[model samples]
Target: MVRERSSHWNQKCRCLLLGLTVILILGAVVVFAAVILAGRRDPPAELPQWKGRGSTANLEEIILGRCFIYTRIVNPELRKDCLKIWETFKNAFVSKNPCNITEQDYQPLMELAAHPIQCNKTLLWSKTNELAHKYTKVQGNLLTLEDTLLGYMADGLTWCGSPSSSETNYQSCPHWRECANNPVSIYWKMASKTFAEAVCGVVHVMLNGSINHAFGNSSIFGSVEVHHLNPKKVHLMKIWVMHNIGEQPSDSCSGSSIKELKSIIEGKNITFSCEDDHRAVQLIQCVGQPEEPACRVCRTEF
Candidate 1:
């Protein structure tokens, strides 16, 4: 009788062990499924369709702020009616077709914001926008279009309007290549022409020597500014061909493109001069590249 009871107890223990094992396995499977499901979350939501390639947000505030700041701090010697300037600027394209904008539309704004550019201080650039501006900032004697009131207010901003609406279109604007007469392109062309026309005495042009055809005919400097330059006012045109510290020189004073520029200027009866890797510009290029061999050599030579 004792043996039978003991066997019965052992059978019960075995059954209990089996039940626990099954329960444990089920729990593990449930946890694994939960972990997998949690890890497989849905992707992030997409942006709104209209939130792309549009006029800058708070465009008026930004432009007006720049205008006030420029008038108050940058060149206090000159006075500007910031409100009037803003109104004129808005009227140019606020109710017009973005693609139909022309240089003439911005004439009033340009004239209203126009300021005297010191003689021999104009700096024109092609394919060297950043470097040219940096050079101007560092040298302080040269001034690019962006340094003036008109260019300063609109630089690096996108703007457009619809013919049907009297408000700025913050949804989308035509790209420069999308249309021959996009609002932004026309404004820059007009600004460039005005700036170039005002240049007198010695004028400086900065070109990228690391790119082919640095002086591209389609560029603002080539097509608009160059055409507007007055031979009688501009006594000399100095070209600086700048190359990156480590880049192979792609174009220089003697390059075909430079030759073409020279021919054009000479034909126009303007004194033309070209220098390869001008020291002042090259020094500016070497600012953050002290380890470069070219920079080291340039440092020693200077």
Candidate 2:
């Protein structure tokens, strides 16, 4: 009886040991699985270079707000779909390689944001941003790039997106000359083309007389804007070369590039006229610098 009782005790202890071992194994497995799941749920600690580092919310707000304000004031007829416009604009570059973005990427946004351009008032400018805007703002009859909806939203803003993320890089962006088709340059080029195609009747181009290559063939006005103008729709291209209030203009109708530009326009069977030291520009200068000898006299001719 004693021997049988001892054997029973030994058997019970063995069973207990086995059960404890199984429980320990199961618990370990559960812990390992939980650790793995927790790791998977966590976000990456480091981001890749291609991933954009900034948010475009501010830019979007600017664009949307401007759209509402400008559309209401400038052209109430344009139905303002701010959200849809933002989505289309963002989708063009967001989660895509910044350098890989092409002019066609912006097509949807361009089509969605189409607004009418008044005929005979479209003004194209090269190296003359401030002057051109001042002229347009005061004149009221003329409209430059910034006067347009798209141009107004994108003016002086730099942004880009990455292929792995849907955020715009507000901190740093590709320089304009970094590549032939950088995001900003591509957008403007496409916008310029759209603006140019809408031209009808007389079109004025403001070229800076102080700069060399005033009519640069590679400029947005030269390459994109000049190319899309249809002779049938556009009757004349008035070249308004602005100079210092009382200085000899560096470029004129006889200048090589200007002459080439004239030839290009005439080749398309459109009449071309160039005026050096435009009177209106000189008068604008006089308003700002009324004390200067040049401003005091305010002569279109030097």
Candidate 3:
């Protein structure tokens, strides 16, 4: 009897231990699941708030200020009726639907803002805004559209109109992609077209080589400017493909897109040539990144 009791006690103890082990495992699993759930519930990083309307604040003052500055300081010799220019620019879209604006609507403004571009001094760029502008400032011999009257006045400002009222829509403006012909987009297209048509002699095109499709067909330079270029006036088209100092180039002069550009220029009976990492531009790029190995090498070579 004693032996049987002892054996029964041992069996009970074993069963109890097994039950405790399962309970501990279940408790661990629950804890682990809670931690995972807490991590998932954490909030995400903040992003830029969407401005339902893309109009720049104080649009008139900004534009008028830029106009006066351009005329009085940038190009003192050229006299422009800043007030008349503003009126004509405002009339283009003040009472019309923002999406319905066309390049023709801006013709009067363009005519008023028109000025002569020096031959071989025009520098057009695609996907290289910052660097191109910097180059213009650094070199002092090249001029982009933004350096001119029309482009300077409206470089960073956004404006649109409401069809229901004869006033600028400060509350909301259509984005460039939201409509086929937003006012801002149409203005740039017309400006680019005009700028291209005025360019003569050796026209320089600066292109970014770090990104794919650096010479895309849809860009203003590719779509509007290239089409508007007057072969009769332009003597040679020089393409400079520039890349970031330390990064490998994603595209080059021999890239498919550039080849397409070359073919198009050839078809137009214009002289075309391309150079990779034009020394002047590369040196300018190196200015901001002197510590980079590639930039260091560039400094040594140049």
Candidate 4:
């Protein structure tokens, strides 16, 4: 009888302990759920706009600014799955400018990105600057002549001669004469055309146009596959501006940054968008009609 009573007490104690253990586990799970919910709070919203000061052509500044935003702000600050994010927008800017390529074989530059980025930046800046300077010099002379004539006109000075003198309105200056002898008129027309055509025309092409040599059918730049390898070592290959005929330095880390586990990129296409939009439009207008500027509408073609 005593053994039976002891067994009953022991069983009751075991049941109580098991029930307590299950309660503690259930309480822990609830607490864990609450903590997770608290941690998730609200996500941050994107900023609406960017700020800067400077007169710009619009297209150039906007495009460059977008690149800056990607390099300096978006790419570094975001800690999300970088490879997946990268693949989403790698060639997005190209949608705005089709000339800009989308898919690139970036296997070569993985070694470079893991380390310092300064070396590559230095090399690209040097080339872009060199070419920009050369372009400036070539166009400077022509632009100067245009500037001088423009100044003269703003002051109401005419090379053809005295603003047409009229008695009906004596205070009014004489209009520029259409007479043949005036050297000022002759000189103005000559200088105006000289620089405007020779200088500004090339400027239009370099800044907005490209001689696309590669990966197209009979394009002006012609099958443009230029390979420039090893900066510190011997530069056996030709070096171009920031954009090469073939490979570009910015493409170095683009590969490792692109691929992700869940996403298969074999033949899949990603439609790209620009986070930083430098909406610059290029419009070329001539002072006179078709004769003065042969390439009057100089936005796309040279």
lDDT of 1 at 155: 99
The candidate that wins on TM-score is 2
* Stretches > 4 Å off in candidate 1: 1-52, 297-302
Q: Please, what are the lDDT tens digits per residue for candidate 3 over residues 1-302?
A: 99999999999999999999999999999999999999989584222222346578888899899999999999999999999999999999887878889878999999999999999899999999999999999899999999999899999888887776777777778776678688989999999999999999999999999998669999999999998999999979999999988898899999999999999998998999999999889888888898877666633544
lDDT of 3 at 88: 97
Instruction: Identify the runs in model 2 with alpha carbons over 4 angstroms from their true place.
Output: 1-27, 33-57, 246-248, 297-302
Q: Give the TM-score (vs. native) of candidate 4.
A: 0.19
Candidate whose lDDT is highest: 3
Q: How many residue pairs clash in each candidate at the backbone level? A: 0, 0, 1, 19
Q: What's each prediction's TM-score? A: 0.81, 0.84, 0.80, 0.19
Give the CA lDDT, 0 to 100, for residue 190 in model 1.
89
Q: Cα lDDT of model 2 overall?
A: 0.81
Error of 1 at 85 (Å): 0.6
lDDT of 3 at 77: 96
Residue 201 alpha-carbon offset, candidate 3, angstroms: 0.5
* Residue 133, model 3: Cα distance from true site in angstroms: 0.5
Q: Tens digits of per-residue lDDT for model 1 on 1-302?
A: 99999999999999999999999999999999999998898765332223238899999999999999999999998899999999999999987878899878999998999888999898999989899998899999899999999899999999888876788888888876678787888999989999999999999999988988868898888899998999989979999998888989888898999999999998889999999889888888888897788677633544
Which regions of candidate 3 deviate over 4 angstroms?
1-52, 297-302
